[model samples]
Target: MSGYPDNPSGHMSGSARTRRADAQRNRERILQAARELVHEPGELKLHTVAKACGIGQGTLYRHFPTREDLLAEVYRREVEDLVAAAPRLLETHPPLDALAAWFDRVAAYARVKRDIFAAVEAATWQDLAAHSLGPIGAAVELLLAAGRSAGGVRADAEARDVIILISWLSRLDDTELDARGPRLLSILVNGLRAHHRD
Candidate 1:
């Protein structure tokens, strides 16, 4: 053999692995900071997010080259997370209860989306929504399917209809949401009961 250590696995060097892990941690931190900052009043500033995350602006830019890039990433991750929640919710709760819980999650997502829209251009917002529709619809369908199978939701209930019904949640002001959101969701859940007209 040559005057070198034997190499088998092609794994990265320890320093390289540490750098990769740090970059991933930084990306997550940036996302978390952006998510919170987007909800604050006025336009979102990249520098503010960098400051919040305790990273330099250049570091932030390396990860997200533009403001739109950062916002879109935040939006995409939120949609991904929301879609992933459906199956998890069903695992621990009854179908109808899981559906209700998912509705609440959707409301929270709506609030984040509202803030994202304010920060992003109309075109960017449209693009984000277009990409998000499929996954979000699938999540809703998953929850509905579980409920229907359990005889808790009406057989005729469609995911599209359920989406339309809850669309109003996005329009509610903070005050109205706090005052009426839970009651409205309760009525919605009750209305979707299997016994409700086919």
Candidate 2:
């Protein structure tokens, strides 16, 4: 046999890897709990999250030093999920349809932002806002380019314009928004559509 440790399970096998995997699982559980709790005013208490996660305070703190840190990570992960949806939307629908679907997703994201805005205020919301739009802008540009190429959207459209239109949806009161947001967004999408050619 070789001089290396006689392990039948490959070159590495031990509790260290198990501990790391457990840590990762705990981290995800903590974030999920945070996401749910952030929607409730003053409910983002870390102890609550730890209790929900069934982990010690030390484990939660190991993943996030402060409530603000946890909030920022949660928001960042939410934005990442939004960005990741673009390709999946495109795969399932035509360009314009995909863009429309993505607009709906954006509306949902904006609602979440409004819900969590109070908690996020204590964190680096400005810095997060500054950088978060880049991924969204790029995703919008991709969708718009595809729409124009497919002759489904106006050639003159820019991602900034759509972003501006969508931003308005986030500002409305939740009730009014719930009542009219879809109609307003439909109009916006309809306006963006390319005129039918002969």
Candidate 3:
């Protein structure tokens, strides 16, 4: 017997699933276009992104009300991707190494997620809640806790501080990051240095 008043597909048509699949495909395509634009610095155009996505201008407009909206979606999904990686990294690497590896991933995002992130930082809570953003703070707490408990990270550090670093990092151009990242990251690692007991 079925658990509901109707079978699983009773209320829905084949068209519904097809539509959902189409929507997902479009979202993926949009994200890919966004990635390309982010990597290319200031050369992005609406038509270029749409051409890369293989979607029409009308379709892109139907999905994203404005460039800001598209940018926001990219950042939201980027955070979702980051949040989802923690468990898999934990399984494959020691806590400290996992944290370090994740930092590398973040550096990549810092490079690519730049255009989208500025829009996100400007977002108010009400503006953001429309999109059902996930809880990044919890994800941060979990990862940082792992690093701290592994006896390889600073006990005094918190994820909030890391959040600030990442937020600022994405705003830099490659020239700036190439000039500054090594020294700043070295300082960061040194700050994470744990105290040795006698």
Q: Largest lDDT belongs to which candidate? A: 1
Task: Show model 2 residue runs off by greater than 4 Å.
Answer: 1-14
Per-residue lDDT tens digits for candidate 2, residues 84-148, read 88889999999999988988888778876665555666447878777888998898898999999
The all-Cα superposition gives candidate 3 an RMSD in Å to the true structure of 5.0
Question: Total backbone clashes of model 3?
Answer: 0
Better of 2 and 3 by TM-score: 2
Ranking by lDDT: 1, 2, 3
Best by TM-score: 1
Local accuracy of candidate 1 as per-residue lDDT tens digits, 1-198: 454333446566687678889999999999999999998888899999999999999999999999999999999999999999999999999999999999889888877787887789999999998999889999999999999999999998898988888878878877787788889989999988889455
How many residue pairs in model 1 have overlapping backbones? Answer: 0
**Which 10 residues in a row give candidate 3 its minimum summed lDDT?**
125-134
TM-score, one value per model = 0.91, 0.87, 0.76
Residue 8 lDDT, candidate 1, scale 0-100? 48
TM accuracy, model 2: 0.87
Candidate 1 has its poorest 10 consecutive residues by lDDT at: 1-10
Backbone collision count in every prediction? 0, 0, 0
The lDDT of model 1 is: 0.90
- C-alpha displacement of 20 in model 1, angstroms? 1.0
